[model samples]
Target chain A: MIQFSNYDIISNLLFATQWTILLSLAAFIGGTSVALLLTAMRLTRNPAMQTVVRIYVELFQGTPLLMQMFLCFFGLSMLGYEISAWSAAILSLTCFTSAFLVEIWRGCIDTLPKGQWEACRCLGLSFLQTLRHIILPQAIRVATAPTVGFSVQVIKGTALASVIGFVELTKVGTMLNNATFEPFKVFTLVALIYFALCYPLSLYSKHLEKKFNVSR
Target chain B: MSLVNLHQVHKYYGDLHVLKGIDLDIKAGEVVSIIGKSGSGKSTLLRCINGLEEYQQGGITVDGNEVTTEDIQVRRLALSVGMIFQNFNLFPHMTVGENIMLAPTIVLKKSKAEAEEIARAMLLKVGLEEKFDSYPEKLSGGQQQRVAIARALAMSPKVLLCDEITSALDPELVGEVLKVLEQLAKEGMTLVLVTHEMNFARDVGSKVVFMHQGKVWEEGDSKTLLSDPQTDELKQFIGAVL
Candidate 1:
């Protein structure tokens, strides 16, 4: 049985936690923008636009993220793209995150009643004007909770990037565990770090939802 | 020239026919009440006038622009033809002032300050000045309906259509909405109303049109139609209700 000092293992895990947060943030921002576009397209009446959005959502939702990561990391490099693990991880996570975010936002939009549409129409506000002023303001109340809660999923999802040789917290912990042959101790620290990042965000989301519901 | 005209308007809901060849004309400063049993096409006729509902076959000109062909033009025409719905359809998120000011600011291009002033005056006109900052849910049923009337009047519509505006309210609350309508009619705002209140039909309406089975059975001066002997259908209807 191999063994290592406690300080060595704990320090290595602590150092990699920062990279996990950074990777999560990059994936989150990239995903949210794409999701906004997908959701808008989903709401459109144009058949072609809706079809494209539906295909995009289905494509991402249908495939496993592990397969997507493998394709992003290995397949692109084979095609002479010369992508880094960081870029591959970001791309895969962004696509995966977008599909779910689009669905969450669409649910928020659906919660609005049909009468709101008629009320805006009779007031002579153009479609965009009505969306910007009337619909979106109300939708924001609903979208806030799920959006923040989804951030936890994003953070957890970044751990999968470790399989592609991305040096996030999980990857670093795996490397440390291999050097010291202490899987239980190293993985425990990694799990705690992930908890630290996600738990606060989860609480904040719940708080926001309760506050908004009461105000409404 | 009449402020509003509809010639042989017919609206169909798939296989269910709603408005069957409705012909109507309203002159300036006229207050016409349409009374009928439920499902008698009273609300559909009002909705068609405001361009809220489309008719399959007919000509509808409100102040002269054809509404059936273009929704945008109908919207433009709707600027001068305001409507009040049975449910009061107010924007629940916005304040009473914001609800009244939205159309003027967006559609009429009025400045925010100008819109606010118009909104304030309108709310005062409807006896809702104190509730300007309140949301629709915060207000009572009568107050919300009054705010809806104020919102419609803020557009400076030449013709106003009230589609069972008081039906959703409590018996006591109904008076507050009708009182506001009475004041608007008194001030010479051309109005068309779909109402169940027989007293309102007899007192405030200069002309009464009784609709039965999607057609106007009889139409004449309010006093003549309500008091004097008429068709058997009218006799039975009045007998059943009274």
Candidate 2:
């Protein structure tokens, strides 16, 4: 049995935490970009495009994230398409995050009065200009707290990626537990790491929710 | 030229008819006030002129541009028509000046400095030059409506359509807004107002259009028609309102 020191264990866990953070940021950025495009599509007058986006949102949001991960990783391979665990995790996670995010943003946008859009239209603003100059600036302020709150979900969600053989914090913890024979210690540390990463965001979201609601 | 012409214009809200074959013409440099009870489609008529509401039938022309729901047509029509709402739809995200400048800077493609100069001039015109940096939320109902007027004026549209522009104000605030509209009317700005201020309509408005059930029930010189009340409906309306 190879012996592992406390420093070695802690350092390895910290390194794995780095991957967890990296995955979360990548997923968030990719998800937001995709969500923006989908949000635009959903708002368009083209019913077919709106329907397509609606179905896309429903398909991803209606399903389990774990199942999505499995399908992206193993299902694709089963069909003879080569894909890496990391790519699969990112891909499935982006879709999952975007599904929730698009709805969250839509709720924020809808909170504004219909008169805002009408006002923009009468000013001769094109739809895109209205969104860019007026609607989104206001909506983004309203969306901030909810968007931050949703990020914690993304960070916690990255743990499920471990089940797909991605060597993130949870996966490394499982491996460490097997070698160290200390579920109480290894998993406790893993859980604590996630708490450290997610707690501030949760607090910040609550703070912002109170701040924006009060100011507005 | 007739700055705005509506010939047998018809509008429908789903199966319910909103504007029933309305025909009216508004010439340049005239102040026309539209008045009626709720659901009479006075507001709908004002909205139709600005291309905000699409009619199921008939045609509307503003400064030689046809009013249509098509994006290009609406954009073209906007150059000729400006509208102020009862709720004072100033962009809350923008400063008083930015709210005034946004349309010109974007739609009219004015340079930022030029837009700001125009915005300042409009703010001065509305007597809110000191509030150029203030946000809409910080202002009172009267102040915000003034800012909205300034915003509309910044576009330099040939015709300004006001839809019950004072209905949302407090009774005290109503005077301030009416005072501004009265001033604009004196300046011969070709104002079209859907209003309830009978006194202001009579005193400042050149014409009063009484709308009933989505049709022009009676219309004529404001001072005479409002005082005389030609139709029984107008008499009833005046009696009910007064």
Candidate 3:
């Protein structure tokens, strides 16, 4: 049996925690910008524009995140390009996160009453003006809770970055377990850390959901 | 020149013909009320004047702008033709002030301060100066409808279209909103209204249009149209209402 010092295990895992947080932040920001763009295209009147956005959303949502990371990391390498694991992780996570974000935001925008559009039209405000000044302002309130809840999913999803050899929390836990040969102990710690990161966001989203009652 | 004109107009909703071979003209500062039963195409006639609906044949011209086209020019025509809906249709997310000021600021390029002043005056005119900061949902149905009227007036439109504006309000609340419209007519704002209020139609309007089955059944001075109907259709309509 291999015996390991708790102090060594704790130090290594704590040191790697920052990478997971950084990955989550990167994915969220990149994904949100892309999602907003996709939402605009999705709502546009042009058929060709709507089709392109639809295909982009479906392609990302239909594929597993694990397959996406492998394809980004190894598949791209076969095309004579060397991409770092961090780059591969971010690219795949962003694509995956944005697809869901676009759908959520589109639902928010769609929920606004038809009268709002007519009212703006009677005012002679252009389509973009209506969206910016009227529609989006109301949509922000409906969008807040679901979007914050999705961030928790995104934080947990950072774990899948480990398969591509990106050294986030899951990778750190695996490495520590290999040295200590304590699979149960290491995974428990990983689960606790994930809960620590995700629980506050989960609670916040629930509170907002209750306060807004936007489902109506 | 007429302030509003609809010539030989024909409109269809897929297989259902709504407006058929209609012709009408209104001069500036005229108050005309159209009375009809539900689905008699009263609302559709009002919508077409503001370019909110398209006619398959003939054309509508409001303030000299053609409204039958699908281009921005049609929207431009709508700028001069402000419409208030049956439901009030106030932007619920906006403050009463913002609802009134949006078009003037965006389409008319009025400065924020100027628009606010104009919006305040318009709201005050409707007896809603106290509710400027309140949202549409925060106000009563009558108050919201008044705010919608103020919103339409803030554009200083050449003509105003009211489509069943008082139909959604409580019976007690209807007078307050009509009082505001009465005040607008007194102020000589050119107005075209579709209404169910027969007493107000007889009293407030100089000219009254009676519509039935998507055609103008009878139209003339309000007193003559109501008191001495020239057609059985108008007699039947007034009989049913009375």
Highest DockQ against the true fold, candidate: 2
Winning model by lDDT:
2
The DockQ-derived docking category for candidate 3 is medium
Each candidate structure's TM-score, on Cα atoms with residue i matched to residue i, is 0.90, 0.97, 0.92
The per-candidate TM-score of the B chain, in the order shown, comes to: 0.96, 0.98, 0.97
- Which has the higher TM-score value, candidate number 2 or candidate number 3? 2
What is the C-alpha local distance difference test score of each model? 0.87, 0.92, 0.88
Question: How well is each residue in A1-216 modelled by candidate 3, as lDDT tens digits?
Answer: 655688777777777788999999999999998998988887767799999989998999999889999999999999989999999999989999999999999899888888788777777877788889988888998999999999998998899999999999999999888888889988898888899999999999999999898534
**Which portions of model 2 miss their true places by more than 4 Å?**
none
- Better-scoring candidate (DockQ), 2 or 3: 2
Q: Residue B174's C-alpha lDDT in candidate 3?
A: 96
TM-score (chain B) of candidate 3:
0.97
Q: What tens-digit string does per-residue lDDT give for candidate 2 at A1-216?
A: 899887888899999999999999999998999999999998877999899889999999999999999999999999999999899999999999999999999999999999998888888999999899988999999999999999999999999999999999999999999999989988889999999999999999999999998987
Query: Which residue pairs clash in candidate 3?
Result: none
Candidate 2 residue-wise lDDT, B20-85, digit = tens: 988898899999999999999998899888888889999998887788988888888888788899
Of the true contacts between chains A and B, what fraction does model 1 have?
0.37
lDDT tens digits, residue span B1-242, model 1: 88788899888999988888888888889889998888989888887876677889988887877765254766677678888888888988799999988889988999999999999999999998999899999888999999999998999989888888888898999998889999998999999999888888889988888888888888889888989738988888887777
Alpha carbon deviation, residue B120, candidate 3 (Å): 2.2
Taking chain A of model 3 alone, its TM-score versus the true chain A equals 0.95
Docking class of 2: medium
Please list the residue runs of candidate 3 whose C-alpha ends up more than 4 Å from where it truly belongs after superposition.
Answer: A1-4, A214-216, B68-71
